[model samples]
Target: MQRKEALDILHSKLKKKNLVKHSLACEIGMKRIAEYLGEDADLWGLAGLLHDIDYEEIEDAEEHGKKGASFLKGKLDDKVVKAIERHTGYIEPKSTMDIALYALDPLTGLIIAAMLMHPSKTLAEIDTKFVLKKFKQKGFARGANREQILACEKISIPLDDFVNIVLKAMQEINEELTG
Candidate 1:
């Protein structure tokens, strides 16, 4: 399916505003990482954008990735579905692209949390150090899933570096993100 079609499907399936925002953040984050790594940005963005398409249908955290992969069986390509499937951190990310998605899947939520807590209440106002500190805090966005963010190390990029890269990209598109 086309990107817009996929987005429409995602929007229809996701009801929570915060969830939708997180999906978009992942999309943008993955897209930037893909560009940095000389991969297909569109494909990466779509993978990130549709990663949680089945979250509502599969409430069990253990089965969410598998369910999402199955849900996109005939809707998207195999690679895209694989990206969604492995995004949950249940399995080790085997590719740079997979690592990118895994890293940002939870990092995006943490960044958003940091942005919301900032005085400016914007992505641009979020500092990399602040986000890194938040990552170490057990009480800050507890569900941000540090395990997934730590997967960034598999790609040779430390967690702080990964967060900075994603946050910078998001800052450039903050208007589109928060608008």
Candidate 2:
């Protein structure tokens, strides 16, 4: 499906404004990471954008990724659907796409938290170094798992490069994300 079609589906399911923006951030980050890794950007992006489609509808907290996967099973590529399921660590990320989503999930949160804390409060104003400092702070963006963010290194993508690519992707869509 096209991005617009996916956005329509995403919007239909998600109620929170911030959650939608988070999905957008994930889409951009997923696409950029796919490009960086010479992977299929479209499928990876759809996975990222829809990974949290079950967020607001989750009955059981543990059903997060499972619900999303079930919802998306036949709608998208199986690989993308599986990546969405594996992203939450419900199943360990095995594919490059799965690992990227696993790592990219919290990484976007980290970047968003870093942007919010920036003096200028803009993604453009914060680099990976600034975000790295925040990563070391135990109390900062407590929901953004530092260990998962570090999973970039597991896939042979250096942590710094992952941060840089994701940060730049968010910056490119700063207005959409910040507004």
TM-score to native of every candidate shown: 0.90, 0.97
lDDT of 1 by residue, 21-121 (tens): 77888888888888877888898889988999888888678787788788888887788888888888776567777778887888888888888888899
Instruction: Give candidate 1 misplaced runs (Cα > 4 Å).
Output: none
lDDT measured at residue 69 in model 2 versus the true structure, 0 to 100: 91
lDDT agreement with native, every candidate: 0.83, 0.92
The candidate that wins on lDDT is: 2
Candidate 2 residue lDDT tens string, 1-179: 88899999999999999999999999999999999999989888999899999999888877889988998878889999999889988689899999999999999998988888999988878998998899899999999988998888988999889999999999999999998
**In candidate 2, which residue pairs clash?**
none
